[model samples]
Target: MRLLQTQITPFVNNFLHIDVREQPFLFCPLHGKPSFHAHPELELVFILEGFGKRIIGNQVTYYETGDMVFIGSGVPHIWLSDPAYYKQDSTLRSKVIVTYINPKVFESMFIHIKELDGVKEMINQAAKGINIFGDT
Candidate 1:
C-alpha cells in the first residue's frame, strides 16, 4: 500500500498534532466553524447537531443531524453550516465528532493478519470515499 505525505495546515500542524506519535488517532469535537481542507489521512465524521451541505471531492449533498460520513485521504471536503450559523447573533450551533486515522496502522494489521482481508478491502474502497449508513 502507498502512503501519501500529510499536508501541513494551520489547523493540523498547530492544533491537531499534539502528541500524535503516542496515539495515531485523533478525536476532535468541533463546533461552529468548519475548515475547507484536505489531508493525508482517513476521516470519519458524525454530525451530532447541524444542518448543512457536505462536499466531498466533486459530490455535494445536504446533511443534517445524525448524519455520518467517511472521507478518504487527500480528498478535499467541508461541512458548510447553513447561512444562519455564520451570523454573529445567530444561536444555532454546529457540532461534529471527527476522528482522523493513520492508514499505516491499518495497513500493518492487514499485512500481518490474513483474517483482516475483508477489512482491508473495505479500506481500499474507502480510498475512493465511502458513505456508510444504517448503523455503520
Candidate 2:
C-alpha cells in the first residue's frame, strides 16, 4: 500500500495540519502532540486503521479503526498506539486524519450562525472530549 505519511502537509492558508503518520506510533513527532498537551485550537481526530489507547481530558479508552473523537480548545489529549506498531520488522501502520480548527473560527461561526446550535452544543461539551461510534 502507498504510504499515507507522505501525504501529510500543512493546510494552505489555514491554521491546520493534515497529520497522517504510518508507523512508529510512539513518540512520532509527525504525530505532533503525542503526549499530554493542550492547545487553544479545536481538534477532530479519526482513526482509519490501527489499534491503541486514546486519552483525552478525563476519558481513557481503547480505540481502533473508525474511532473518531472531537476535542475542544485547551483539552489535553494523546494517541498511544500499541507497542507492536513500533517493533522492528513490524508491518503495522496507523492511518489517522487529524483536523485542527482555530478557536477564532469557531467563535465567529457560532456568533452569527443560529443554525449551528447543535454543533455549538457539541463543541461546548467537547471541553471534556467527545468520542463518536456505532455507525453499523
Candidate 3:
C-alpha cells in the first residue's frame, strides 16, 4: 500500500506535530456547539460513548456507542445530541477518533481506469451521501 500524506488541520496541531507523523490524531472535547463543516480530506470517525446524530449533507442519522462513520472528502457534516441528553454532569458528547486522507488517493486509483467503472459509479453516488449500518 502506498503511503498517503494526510493534511494536518490546526484543530489537531495543539496536541502534537501531526503534520510530520505518518498517521494523525485529533481529539475534541465531547461537548460543544452543534455545527457542520466541510473537510478537504476523507474522514473516519469512531464513537466510543454518548449519543448524538450525524448530519451528512441532507442525510441525518442517530449514533451511539460503537458507531463508526466514514465520510469522504468535501462532504459537509456535523454531529449533535438531543437537548435531553445534554445536561450538567452528563457526558452527552460522543468521543470520536477521526482520520483524514486526500481525495487524490481515490482519484489515483479510479480517475483514469476503465475497469473500475463500478467504483467510479460508487464515487459519484458518494458525492450525495452514504450511510452503512454497522450491524451489517
- Measured by TM-score, the strongest candidate is 2
Per-structure clash totals for the candidates: 0, 0, 0
The 0-to-1 C-alpha lDDT of every candidate, in the order given, reads: 0.63, 0.72, 0.56
Clash-forming residue pairs, model 1: none
Query: Per-residue lDDT tens digits of candidate 3, residues 1-136?
Result: 1222334344443332212211111222222234466655666666656566777777877877677676766777776665556566654444555655555555677758889888667656766556556573
Q: What TM-score, computed on C-alpha atoms, does each candidate reach?
A: 0.72, 0.79, 0.60
What is the lDDT, from 0 to 100, of the residue 20 in candidate 2?
Answer: 66
Model 1: per-residue lDDT, tens digit, 1-136? Answer: 1222345343453233322211111122232235556787677777777787777777889888778787776887766677777677777766667667666555677778999998777767776567778874
Q: Mind giving the per-residue lDDT tens digits that candidate 2 earns over 1-136?
A: 1112212224423556556655456333644535666767787888888888877777889889888888888877677888788788888878877787766666787889999989988889999998888783
With candidate 3 superimposed using the best TM-score fit, by how many Å does residue 71's alpha carbon deviate from the native?
1.7
Q: Give the TM-score of candidate 2.
A: 0.79
Error of 3 at 32 (Å): 6.9
